[model samples]
Target: MARVKKKIRQEQLIEKVKNKPFLTDEELAKQLDVSVQTIRLDRLELGIPELRGRIRKMAENAQNKVKAIQSNEVVGELIDLELGHSGISLLKITEDMVFGKTQIAKGHFMFSQADSLAMAIVDAPMAVTGVANVKYKVPVHVGEKLIAKAEIVKVRGNKYFIWVKTHNETQEVFRAKFIVVSWGEK
Candidate 1:
């Protein structure tokens, strides 16, 4: 690959991360057709931190807004929340989340993140997940950050139909529709 000018490479890197902060250095290197070391140096020069750091930073900003469940009990960090409407969260897949042989994340982690986000979006005192229809679109690996976005699709009486879709930078990893029973509906 012809060498991308340092300035152009930095600009592209910034834009890439702007679009998806969860991208790893290796992924960025592959996307930009540059060496990983070059990518690292470019990130450093551009005042960008490593992938995990970036994820933590993004999650830190929104983690405190969680209401339905205690922040620690939720599977992921609650980054954005608008009760009775929509919300977003972040989950970082770790070694413990993956199977030993395949290195693919266990399914429960994704479900937990989605389910919690679904419950969090209900604007009631008590929210319970009555039924979940979920699908795993792709296998996730360790060190990947998942951004889960949840929207309240419908509300009938005390029941909220919520949709959650989790994705990495390039593709969807998990999607689910949750029927949540909000006990304290006005």
Candidate 2:
């Protein structure tokens, strides 16, 4: 009976990680109602890497596909990319990114994350932002994770229109529309 339960729990663990690969061992343990050590052991048995390993694999795969900019130039960790179409990035708000008293993240950090994501989706050797229309919908605090997604809306000549929306865990915090110009090829 105990072995059967363990097998079932392991199956649940696999499914949970598949649905959300970024979950940490502590989070997984909480969700599974098991100890952190048990979660780690089960992950080993199931041949699953930890959260950082999983993120590194994702970043490596996405970085190889980037063309407009070097992967390291991305303002956040580039996790998904389809050149000329769409891309996604993740940013964690740290102490240095927020105001000293307000504890609210600086707007430039969010804009940079969105703008860079928009630039990355352009399939060109050189891409530069021509215009940016942005709005900060809500304030984000330190220790929060931000996910920015960018999509190309239209293309004309060497100009690309892209939209980026950034969300914290609970709600959308920022949005932008970018006009990008790209030329030549590397």
Give RMSD to native, each candidate: 5.5, 3.2
How do the residues 1-186 of candidate 2 rate in per-residue lDDT, one tens digit apiece? 999999999999999998788789999999999999999999899999999998888788889988888888999899988788998899999999998989899999999999989988899998999999999999999899999999999999999999999999889999999999999954
For candidate 1, the lDDT comes to 0.85
Pairs that collide in candidate 1 are none
What TM-score goes with each of the models?
0.67, 0.76
lDDT for every model?
Answer: 0.85, 0.92
Expressed as tens digits, the lDDT of each residue in 55-119 for candidate 1 is 67766655565556566766788766666788888899989899999999999999999998888
Best of the candidates, TM-score: 2
- Cα lDDT, model 2, residue 18: 81
* Model 2 misplaced regions, further than 4 Å: 1-20, 23-48
